[model samples]
Target: MLTKDDVRGVSAMIPTPCKEGQGGWQYEDSVDLDETARMTEQLIAAGIGSIAANGTTGECAALTLEEKLAFTRTIIEVARGRVPVFAGITTLGTKETVRQMRKFRELGVEGGFVGLPLWQTPTITNSVKFYADLAEAVPEMALMVYANPLFFKSTFPVEFWEGVGKHCPTVVTCKYVGNLMDPKNMLIDLPASMDAAPHVQFLPIDFAAPMAYDLVGDRLKGMWSTSCAMGPEPVVALQRAIDAGDKARMGEIMHDLHGLPNAIPDFKEFSKYNVQVEKIRCNAAGYIKAGPCRAPYEDLPDDWRALTVASGKAWAELCARKYR
Candidate 1:
């Protein structure tokens, strides 16, 4: 069984719920006792050992503070100590992030995965201070810095990360999710700074498993999964292969996993309809009872929902059989 410190183990980014017609995913107030319990159960059964709610994949940008509280509470309860829960501090600003980070710590969450504020609220110096100060504020829980290049202007260039790491020694990981395909993209120019980063983790959200395994695998603690979020069986198998030093097995698993990307159409191909497609697929996978999402991302048209669900159902069935 994977424990709290094994943060790199397969974890999920759950979808957020909001009130219908309010342009946000609604919370049914039933997630903790049932919905989350079910989701975590499925994930764990398939070898996943962690859960991260309220991240970008969960629509954290659209959630209210109250919703964040509710979501984290449910996730913690439902996980039932079976797997570590890393609460996402998806606050739009530094003050909110601090407050939420404190809140999750109080609730006994295992660790925190936070991103830099989206806009220009904190000066670069203040941003470093924010993380440094936050580390002091929550002395108990470990922290992981999320690197979402699309959301923040100052995501990278190693020097910045090294500076932030200096302030918060508890920050044990960096979720580097950009185009880290080429070794020089990250390691060559910033190897020294990255090596000296405060955290012990350097995880990437990449599907290019072979490239990552070959180039930067030695430096990373783990890899995040968007594709594997919905398909944990093979993902876990691949992860275990990587850990066991079974290069042949790792390549085989990677080939099977990446093939799905070719099958699932690009989000742009569906335009604004991609989210709807995603929800429908989630429903088909048994994570959600209904195919509902926030405005623009919710209530997908029936046609797209049907097609996506059909595909997802086939995939889920395949995974179930193979995993079982």
Candidate 2:
């Protein structure tokens, strides 16, 4: 089984590929395994430490159980132990979540990030039990818990994390997507409180990684990057800057990356279209074929193609910069 430190470094979140349909909308067949496996190989070649498939970036909630397992197996098969591969085990049922993790473990995946079951946010006792049960069910597989306010309805206090860390030895990472301010406090205070859960590393979500890296420094060594899946070089370059403590280069890389999301006009309006944007970015970077997201997610905006291309080129240029 993988440990917390073993899973450190750049983990890319892959976007699911879909088959194009009439009116440019995506159909149920959008999950193309061959394309996904190809994308995973590309990220590994680009120096990503791990591959996180079926996460929110992969549109986890949108995929069926079979599709999720297929994605995990494809990643594992393509990766061939070159690096750790993680599947997102977020589903609506507790037993179902465990079932998926077991499947991933059976396929030889090292670990995965899991979110709470959908629709219902149980009390702290039940929540703690949920994680404990999950760990017990899949004792051999390492796990990361995703705590995002935007995605989850209830507040998961640090104490809850402490409980998970204490009880679930397999829980090695916590991807905290709550307020940016929260990590600051956790960085200062939570370590001692969470000592019982010694191996559980805390990380901010991908979008907030730059700020988190800047503030938390070495304590927060690894990150999960969505942009890196589409374009790993830029994100890897940024990580190198942070590791070397090159504030100037870090600033330069940030300058290049910080504005990328905004390149889409009315970004806030289409902000919820994350998987679609990632697909566009990945396609622009030549990692996969460009296509639309599945149902309920409308077609990519008119200007997204142009903006994604611009963003991809600019990012590639930044990646070429000398970090030494």
Candidate 3:
């Protein structure tokens, strides 16, 4: 069984590799279980605190229900109690989301990471009800609320967050990826407000973990890590530095980790290729067998593909130098 404390470190967002098939794209509808299992083993070997499956980086919206559950089951199976597998439940409505969560729970998963229902942007009351319904439906399972306003299109106020946390004890963590506050000249934002609901730990998305750590330090439980998905070593190393209170080492690791993506042209603007780039990095690092993303997403421009692969290789080289 996994506890809330188990998630207080670097949890890798494991990517779902596609299989070769007779489609317009090279890899479509083919959930490559062998490669996914292999990748899970590698992440475990690299010392990731936990594995998060079917996230944005994992192309959760692109997968079928069957593929999603299969991927989650494979991760849990391969993990073999070495580390807890936190399944990602991203669906259209509260009913479907609850179904997915219950299914993963039936599969023996201890917990899940669920984003706000994306079908429509509900009001704070409805959002609170949505999560409350989910928590009530599956009272035994724990959840981490995904707070990225870019996709969810709603900024939940502190009251709303605390409402959900206090109302549902099953909701243990909240990963905020929105523009909640100034990352530059800030000491604390979410964590201080989150004290109202002491059970729920607040974390920035993995990208902002360094800034959050630099400002709030150990006040954060841990980030929901996307960077750790691609480059686990440097990201985990950064967390270790923060834990040890070594400022100099933290700066070095942050540079090495952030520098990897910045090495590419207009990397910040390359949101379209974010999933592909992470998959490319995992392949470059020998974490998974190389494969294209499922259709619609597979049609990457040649230049973008070239740049992403080059960036992944360059990042791997940096990781080898510093983390190895």
Candidate 4:
């Protein structure tokens, strides 16, 4: 079975640093990675041992195959084994994803990070088979399951994950980026993985992580922490409190954590607001290398950005201070 140390350090989802202009996602000749590298090095300096690129937050689905490879290669070069580099493979089909996994294995990937197989004809049963086929393709490397409900209609139940774990043990850790309420229910469903598979490492990765730390998480590994983006001080403080089992300090940190949701405006205009808030928060916390976002999903309207930044800065500042 994979232990927490094997897969449970903080992992940063790499943001594709976008330049505003004419075309969509066209990487101009050789990929320029200075911005991406800076973001990565910031995380490493902050104390995380590993990082992942091209996932949902990184907009993996939007990249072409060569572009994804170029993106992955940039991560590999900077990571350079300082920490294990995990790359996201977001193909819609098992065969294509399996082929991508094989390539990652050759590139010295520590494990494969696969988001749920959605945007396809899917059944929970078919989801189980999809993972099985991928595991069979790369017998040497382990796998990480990424759960994001935003993209597709398919949400695999805990039983589905248990079934996959039972069938293939190499799928070591599950990055459960689902609803915060999922833990209470999952505990009831998954009793134990059988001899055919290893115990699945359950990660409680609802974006509301520190808030869920005590309330909903008893058996979980911590989240795929976004708190890391705000610099190391607060995240490190929170992680230490969590590790020491210090409930008092944990509570203090989570106070800021609980308020994180307050940064967004309370309105139906959220899908656009979320990406905007996330980017501004990143900037306010001194984590981002660039300017306000580009278009379509571009910058928040002037009025909203001003209000959100004031709100975000306050909330983020509380973390840096309160976590201490």
Candidate 5:
């Protein structure tokens, strides 16, 4: 099994490329494997530390199991061991999740990016047991806990981390998306979570990377970014700036990033349709061909669509000016 050290640097969460039809809503033959292959090569060439697919950005809930398998296979093959790959295996139940993780492990992925089972709110003990069961079943596969309070029921307090640390050794990292909007909550919660789970490295989202790096220093191994779908150059540069302790450069890059969401008409409302907004920006940026958002989550207002396009283009312009 891998350790926290094995999972480091700018970890990117990429959207799955959907085949074009019906104005970006396709139910059949949804995944565009050739485009996925090209996108994988682009990310690796851009110096991304790792690649993660089939998350919320990747439309995990909409993608069929066969589509996900083919998508993961394309990424693993194209990467060819250049960077570590973590594929999302989150499902509605533990048994199905285990079954999916086993498939990805056999495909030669380094680990699984998973969320807690979503049918009911999990208690602290069951939460610990959920991960413990996964580790016990697939001892060979490392785990990255997807700690998203927005989508899942659990808030994942420090006590939860304590239970995980005590019971689950195979959990090497967490995609720490909880309490991100409230820095006051983060200040108290993040470090406490770290203390409770010493072995698991916590990768905060790109917006919070600088604060997290300052808070924990070298112990903060890497960051998770959905913006990398626009282009990895800026995020990779941000990582480099953090590593060098160059606060000025970090600020410049973050300013550009922070502007992206502001370009949207209403960020809070836009956030509700995260999948569509992300795909629009990615296509607008023209970095990787992130075709379109898939079915059941593809609807977006015309006003939101226009602003998302501008936001993505703004990011592209920033990349060209600063990193390209």
Candidate 6:
């Protein structure tokens, strides 16, 4: 089974590349496997610590089971065990989630990123049971809890983590996009959640990472980043600074990051079109071809498009200077 030690640095949540003219969610065999392989190689070469695909950023909801399986296989083949690879196995119910995870495990994925079943808001007891059941069923597969309050019903409170620590041993990490709206909640929850589930690494997203690392020291372990899709070097540089305890350097990188055009002042507004914005930035960065946002979520407001593209271009420029 995987452990907290197995996950480190920047864990990149990458986008799925859609084939030309096939960006619609319902399009059959729309995933570009060759590009997927190339993208995987690009990330590994650029020093990403680990790679996760088919999450919110990867358009997990829009991908067909066959496409997801193919995408997972492509990434695993390209990675060739160079860096740990995780594939999202989130579904609307427990049975399907387990089924998808089993398939991905067969394809040699290191772990599965799972979110809570989304049909209804699960009670805290049921939430714990959901993870426990998955662990029990797929004892060989390690799990990363996808704890995003914006997409899922559960906020993943301290109580949930306490139950997971006791009942779900295979859960080794979390893609923690915690309560960003209430910064005070994070001030309370980050420490308390870690205390409740000491064995699991709670990886805060890129924006919140510096604070999280300072709050918990080495226990912060790593971070989950969608922006790394723009390019990993800048994000990896931040990881190195954090590890070296270079607070000044950390501030420098973060300041430039916050200066990006897509770094909206209000996170709530940003969340509304995050999936689309990420795709725009990734395409603009041109680090790897991210193709287009999959259907139903593809459209972005005109102002958001302009800013997002500008952010992507700005990131590419910053990356050129190596975030000087």
**TM-score of each predicted structure versus truth:** 0.80, 0.83, 0.88, 0.80, 0.94, 0.96
Backbone clash pairs for candidate 4 read 294-298
Angstrom error at residue 12, model 2: 0.6
Please give the CA lDDT of all the candidate structures. Answer: 0.61, 0.69, 0.71, 0.61, 0.85, 0.85
Worst 10 residues of 5 by lDDT: 20-29
Query: What residue pairs are clashing in model 5?
Result: none
- Arranged by lDDT with the best first, the candidates are 6, 5, 3, 2, 1, 4
Candidate 2 per-residue C-alpha lDDT over 233-273 given as tens digits, one digit per residue, 9 for 90 to 100: 76777666766777787687767777554545553454476
Candidate 5 local lDDT, residue 191: 83
lDDT of 4 by residue, 110-199 (tens): 677787665675677777777788778787767777755555455556567667866755677666555333434432332242222345
User: What are the candidates' C-alpha RMSDs?
Assistant: 4.2, 3.6, 2.9, 3.9, 1.8, 1.5
**Model 1 residue pairs with clashes:** 17-25, 17-26, 18-25, 18-26
Residue 107 CA error for candidate 2 (Å)?
1.6
- Which parts of model 3 are misplaced by more than 4 Å? 1-3, 21-29, 180-188, 261-271
Candidate 1 off by > 4 Å: 1-5, 17-33, 121-126, 180-194, 261-277, 287-291, 299-311
What digit string (tens of lDDT, one per residue) describes model 5 on residues 90-117?
Answer: 9999999999999999999888999999
Candidate 6 lDDT at 230 equals 83
Candidate 1: tens digits of C-alpha lDDT, residues 111-162: 7878887767445676677678777877677776776555555546566666
Error of 3 at 267 (Å): 7.5
Candidate 6 residue 208 C-alpha distance from true site, Å: 1.2
Q: What is the lDDT of candidate 1?
A: 0.61
Ranking by TM-score: 6, 5, 3, 2, 4, 1
State which candidate has the highest TM-score. 6
Predicted candidate 6 versus true structure: per-residue lDDT over 83-201, tens digit per residue: 88889899999999999888998898879999999789889999999999999999999999999888888889999999998999999999988777876455458888999998898
